[model samples]
Target: VTYSRSPASPPDGPAHWRPWRFRMSNDVWGTPVVAGDLLYVTSFEVHALDVATGRRQFKTKDVAWTMAVDGGLIHGSDGPTVYALDAAGGHERWRVQADAWVYSLKARRGTVVTGTRGGGVQGWEASNGEKLWEITGAQTDFETPESGPVIHGDTVYIWKDARLRALEARTGMERWSYPVGDAASCGGVPVRVCAAPDGHVYVVAGTRVLAVDIDAGMVRWHFEAPAVFLSAPAFAPGPAVTGGGVYLADYLGTVYALDATTGKDRWRIATESRQSIEPVLVTGGNVHVGSGSAVYTLDAVTGTPMWRFAAGGEVMGSPVVADGRVHFGSADHVLYTLDAAGGQLRWKLATGGEITGSPVARGGVVYACSKDRCVYALDAVKGTATGRAR
Candidate 1:
C-alpha cells in the first residue's frame, strides 16, 4: 500500500509513499544494515536484499542474533557459535564456537570481536575465524562483561568486571583500563559506550556518564545524574557528544547538556513523560530524543524545547537525521518522517507490526524493519516506495 504525504505537511515537503516491502520468514527486531548495494536484516535467519528493488539477493540460516559488516564480510553469532559470511553472497566463510552464548559482535580492521555471556570478551581473526585473544571475566551474571568490544579506530572498548578496558583491535594488546564503578549499581542493565571524534569515549555507568581520554585511557570527567540511565537492546540512550557538548537523558525523563570537556552541566530540562527516553541525536545545533510516544526537538545549547511530534505508540527506536529530516519508528507499527528543524510531520506509513528499530537512509532511500517480519524501503524525500513489493 502507498502512503501519501500528510495533509498537514508543508508544501515543500517531499512526496511520501511506500515503494516496496520485502517479507521475511520471522520477526525482525534489528535495524537494517546498509552495506554497499545490499541491505541486510537478521531474524531467525539473515537475508540480503537489493537496496533499490527490494529483491532478495540471498538468504542464510546462520541465525545471527547480532551482526556486523566490515570489509566485505558479515560477522554474526547465534548461541555459542560465531560466524563470518561473504557479504557479496550468503556463503559462509568460517564459523567458530565460543565458550559461552555470544551477545554482541563487532567486525572491523580484519578483527571480529564478541562479547559472550559469562565468557567475557574475545577477539578473532576476521579472515579465517581463528581465535586471537580472550579476556575471561567472572562467571557470575553481574560481573560478566556488560556490553561492547566497541571499536574506534585502532582501539576497542569494553565494560568488564565493573571497569572499562581498551584493547588494540588487531593484536588484542591492552592499551589501558579505567574503573568506572560498581556494575551492580546499574541494576543489571548493560552499560554501553560511544566514541567521539574529539579523542574521548563516553560510557554510561549506572547513574553517571564518564568521559575517558581515548589515548590516555583515563577518566577526564564524569557527570552524575539524579537517576539511573535507561537503555534497550541495541538502542541504548547513551550520551551524544558533538560540538563541545554531551547530551543525554535519564530514566526520569531529564535531559542534560554538558560541556564535553569539563563534564559540567550547561543546561538540563525535564520532559513531560517521566519514563525512559531513547538515545539522543544532536545535529544542527539541536537535540532530538524520543520519550513515551513522542519525538522532541530541543535547542542543543539551551535545552529549550523547540517542538514535539506525537506518534500512536512509544518511540522505542532512536531517530536518524538525514538531509534536514528525522526518521524513526514507533511501537504503533509506523514509520515517521519529520522536518528536522520544525518537527512537522512530513509523512507516516503504517506497517504490519511494531517498528522498534531505527530507520536508515542512504542514497535518497530510507530502509526500516518491522516486527511484521519485513523490511520496507521508501524514497527519502518523497517517501514513495521505490520498487514493487515482494
Candidate 2:
C-alpha cells in the first residue's frame, strides 16, 4: 500500500513506482467519486472500479454529464432521460424521460431533483423514479454551466430569472425568493453559491457578493467589488466559509477573506494570473488556491504568501488536503502530491492527457481522472502506481 520513495526525494528522478490506472473508451472530464470501496467515473460510459485493485466491477453506457449517488442508487441524466442504477451492480433500476433536456441532477432524502433546459424543475422519487412535483417559470440559461441547483439540508436553492429561489427538497414547493437585481448580469461568468453553517447562504453575482439569511430568505449584507469587466466563460468556484470567515477568489485573481457576519474584509491578496476555475480550499489554517500554472498557499489569518509550487500547466482544479498532503491535477497531464506543511514536492506522475478535475483520496489511495481516458489510483505517500495500469 506504500511506495518506496521517501518524502524528501526530489520530484523528478526515477523511483519505485506502482499505480493502478483503468482506461475508458472516452475522455474523462468529471472528478472521480469514491463511495465505499468502489470508485465511480463517467465519460461516454459510467465505470465503477475497485479502489484498491483497479479492477472494473461494472461499466454501463449511462452517458451522464451530471451524476449523484445516494440511497444505494446512482442517479444520472443523459439529455432528457433520467436513469437510476444499482450502485453495486450497475443495473438499471428505473428511468424517467423529463419534459426537457436535463441541466442538473441531485439526489438526497430519497428524492431525485432535476433542473431542465426550459426553466423546469422537477422532483422525483429516488426509490422508484416516480414524479413527485414540478415547477416552471424561471429561465435557465444554457450558456451558464454553473446554474445547477444546490441542495442544503431540506431546502434546494437555485437561480431563476435573476432571482434566487429556495424550494422544498422533497416536495418542490417554493419557500421564498430573493431578487438579485442588476447584479445578475455578469456577462457569461457563472454564479457561485455556497450555503454555510453560519445560517447564511452566499452568492456571487456579477461584481457583488451577497450574504442571504437562510431562514428569512433576505439579504443580510452585500459586498461590492471594484468595477471590472468579467469576461470568463469558464465555471467560477464557490466561496469557502469556515473559521468565522468567508474565503473566495474573483475572476481577476484577487483573493478575499471577509467576516462571515459583518461582510467586512479581513484580508485580500492578488495573484499574478487570473484565479483558476476551482474552489478555494481552507485547511490547517492555510488557504490553497490554484492560479495560472501554480498552486499558492497563504496564511489564512493574514493572507501572507507562504509557498508556491508551479506546474507545467494551469492548476485548474482544487487541491485536496488529506493526511497532511495536498493533491491536485494540472493541464500538463500530471498529478502532483506535495507536502502540506512546507509545499515541497513529494511525487509527480504523468498521464496521457490534461487533468481538469480534482483528485479524491480515500483509505491510502489517491484517485484521479484525466482527459487521456484513464483513472489512476496511486499510493498516497509514495505517489507510485499500485493496482493495475491498463
Candidate 3:
C-alpha cells in the first residue's frame, strides 16, 4: 500500500502506510535502551537494530531469558551460563557460569554488573566480558533477587533480604547497608534506586521512598503513601544537589511528586488504574506516562491533567517523546503517535501483535518491538513510511 503523507489525525483514511522489518514474537520485559545508531531490544532474544533501516545487525539469544546492556556489552543469563555479547554485533566475547541464572544487569563507571537468582552480584569487564569481581552478599536468603541493581558514582545498590545494601562497583566490596522496615523477605525483590544529581540516593520499598546521603549512607528523609510501588522511581530534570524530589507511581495508579530534600509530598494525582510501566519523559513542565488504554500528559508541578490520547488497546509500554511527539505501543497491536502539546492523534500503525516493550526515539526515527516477533523503524515525518512488512 502507498499513499501521500497526511496529517497524523487523518480526517478520512490512514495517515501513512509501511511494513515492519523483523518479527520477534515474545514478551518484551525491558525497555529499549538507545545508545547512538544502535537500539538494544530484548525479548526471548535480544537484537540490535539499525536506527535508520530497522534492519537486524545482530541477534544474541544464547541466554534467551534475561538480557541487559551496559557500556558496550549486552549480558544474558539463562540459568547457568551468562553470555556477554559485543553491543555492536552478535559476537560472543566471553561466557561465565554462575551458581544460578543472572536475572538483572546494571552499569556504572565503565563496569558491567549483574545479579543472579542465587543472590550474588557479579561484575564483568565492559569490553571483554571478563569477571572483574563477584560478591555473594547472601545465599538467596530464602528468596531470589528480583529488582535490578542500581549503580551510583562509585557504589552499587541492591536489595537483599528486604534491606538495601551499598557495594563498591569496581570491586564488589561491601561499603554500607541499611535495614529499611523489616527483616522478613519481601520475596527478595531488589529495591529500586534513583540517583539524584545531588550526592543523595533514593530507594523505593513497598509503600515508602527513602532518601540516603551518599557520604553518610544514612536516611535523610522518607515519604510514605498508601499505594505500593512495583516499578523504579524516576527523577525530573534538575540539579541533583539541592536534593530534588522524585516522581513515582504506585500499584494503585496514584502518581506523586515528592520533595527530594524533605521527602514531603508536593502534588499527587490518582489515575484510578495500575501503571506497570515507569513514567518516561518529563518535558515542558509535564510528565508523560502510559495508563491502561490511554496516554496522559500531566502538569509536572501541579499534577493537573493536561491532555490524554485514547488508544485502541491497553498501553503497556512507556511512551517515547521526541521532536514534540509522543509515541507508544498498545496491546491493541498499534503504534500511536500524538501531539505532545495538544494530545491530538498524529497517526496509528498496525502491527501483528501486542507491544509490550517501550520504544526508543532518536533523530528522525523510532525503534519499537512487539510480541509479533518484529522490530519496526518508522519515519518521524508525517505521511512517510520506511522498511517492509512481513
Task: Specify the highest-TM-score model's number.
Answer: 2
Model 1 misplaced regions, further than 4 Å: 1-18, 138-146, 231-243, 272-278, 385-388
Taking all chains together, the TM-score of candidate 2 against the true structure is 0.89
Candidate 2: clashing pairs of residues: 18-384, 18-385, 18-386, 19-385, 19-386, 20-388
Clash pairs detected, candidate 1? 15-382, 16-382, 17-383, 17-384, 17-385, 18-385, 19-385, 19-386
Candidate 2 residues lying further than 4 Å off, grouped into runs, are 1-18, 142-145, 182-184, 227-243, 386-388
Ranking of all predicted structures according to lDDT, beginning with the best and ending with the worst: 2, 1, 3
Q: After superposition, how far is residue 342 of candidate 3 from its true place, in Å?
A: 1.5
lDDT tens string, model 3, 1-390?
A: 432333432233222423336555556555676776677777667878665445568877564566667767776767677777878877887777776676666666677777776667787776666787886754354343345666778788766655677878888787778886443433223356777777778777767788888767889997877866766777765632332357878766787888776777888887757556464356667777777788888887778888988888788668878888888889999888888999988877787788767776665556677777777766654524544553
Once model 3 is optimally superposed onto the true structure by TM-score, how far is the C-alpha of residue 241 displaced, in angstroms? 16
Residue 95 alpha-carbon offset, candidate 1, angstroms: 1.6
Q: TM-score of the candidate numbered 3?
A: 0.85
Predictions: Cα RMSD each: 4.7, 5.0, 4.8
lDDT of 2 by residue, 94-205 (tens): 9988898887888888888788877788889999999998888654654233456767788887767778888888887888888764334754555667777777888776
Q: 102, model 2: CA deviation in Å?
A: 1.3
Candidate 1 CA-lDDT value: 0.76
Which of 1 and 3 is the better model by TM-score?
1
**Residues 1-390, model 1: lDDT tens digits:** 544344422233233423578887778877789988788888877888886567799888767788888999988888689999999988999988899888778777898888877747788999999998888872234332234567777788766666778889877788898776555776555576778777788878778788888889888897778777764211112343433477778776777777876888878888755354346787777878888888889987567799989989988568899889999998899899999989988888888899956898876668899888878887677675434457
Off by over 4 Å in 3: 1-20, 24-29, 137-146, 182-190, 239-244, 275-280, 383-386
